[model samples]
Target: LSSSMYEQIFDRTVSVKQRDREVSSFQLTYWINWHRNRHAPVRVLIREF
Candidate 1:
């Protein structure tokens, strides 16, 4: 029973880390897209003028 409990705890910790990694990756992609979009309009306007 103690071993099983330990395993469960370990599994929960691993899942939490996995979730954190996924969230960070999602944030990174979002940041990159925002950065690109922020500059895209300026570039377009410069080209037009």
Candidate 2:
């Protein structure tokens, strides 16, 4: 996804997450494997990897 999309996700998710006590910080991780020729996989940062 583009940086613009990432920015939106960052803003929206943070507010929703604040309602819960389990969350600490926020992070966005992505990987592009063109060899697979499929969509990228994104993992939202949780307490663990």
Candidate 3:
């Protein structure tokens, strides 16, 4: 998928995850941690490429 598509999916998924956790105060932390973890699969895909 295109980068924008990836971003949309990521944003939606992150929002859902944050909602599930109900940690509005720690949103920045959750975003950072979730973002870090989310890149793992892309890294693997890059390596494969």
Candidate 4:
């Protein structure tokens, strides 16, 4: 019973780590896209004027 509990804990930790990695990567890409989009309009305006 103790061993099974330990296994469950380990599995939970691994899943949490995996979720964290996925969230970080998603946030990174989202930030990059936002930065690009935010700057693009300004760049175009500067070019136009």
Candidate 5:
């Protein structure tokens, strides 16, 4: 997917870095609540530069 698509899916706009470098990051969260106890949702972060 393109940058526009990434921005749309992540709900944020992407901007170019001004210091002659670029960085991209994303986060995803999910959970399964089939057990009896409550717990925090799993989260993952992806980064590319």
Candidate 6:
């Protein structure tokens, strides 16, 4: 999804950092319960205006 400048979207400001670690993370998933389905996993890319 496309978003606008901070003036329009930001209510506050903050910074975040991740710690380096060696770990095996497991993925949890479930199937759709409805009729419609995804053809494949969703994809993202750099948006050019």
Q: Which residue pairs collide, candidate 6?
A: none
Ranking by TM-score: 3, 1, 4, 2, 5, 6
lDDT of 1 by residue, 1-49 (tens): 3644544554464356456756675664564356346443334223322
State the lDDT of candidate 3 residue by residue for 1-49, as single tens digits.
6666766676666567656856564774666556657563454334322
Q: Where's the lowest-lDDT run of ten residues in candidate 5?
A: 27-36
Model number with the top TM-score: 3
Candidate 5 runs further than 4 Å off: 12-49
Writing each residue's lDDT as its tens digit, candidate 4 over 1-49 gives 3644544554464456456756675664564456446443334224322
State the C-alpha lDDT per candidate: 0.48, 0.41, 0.57, 0.48, 0.27, 0.19
Score residue 10 of candidate 3 by CA lDDT.
Answer: 65
Model 6 ranges with Cα > 4 A deviation: 1-19, 27-41, 45-49
- How many residue pairs clash in all the candidates, one count each? 0, 0, 0, 0, 0, 0
Give the clash total for candidate 2. Answer: 0
**Between prediction 2 and prediction 6, which has the larger TM-score?**
2
lDDT of 2 by residue, 1-49 (tens): 6755754565465556565676554322221223113332234333213
> What is the Å distance of residue 30 in model 6 from its true position?
9.9
Of 3 and 6, which scores higher on lDDT?
3
Q: What is the C-alpha RMSD of each candidate to the true structure, in Å?
A: 19.7, 8.9, 8.7, 19.4, 12.0, 10.8
Taking the tens digit of each residue's C-alpha lDDT, what string does model 6 give over 9-33?
2212111111223321221112111
User: What shift in Å separates residue 32 of candidate 1 from its native position after superposition?
Assistant: 30
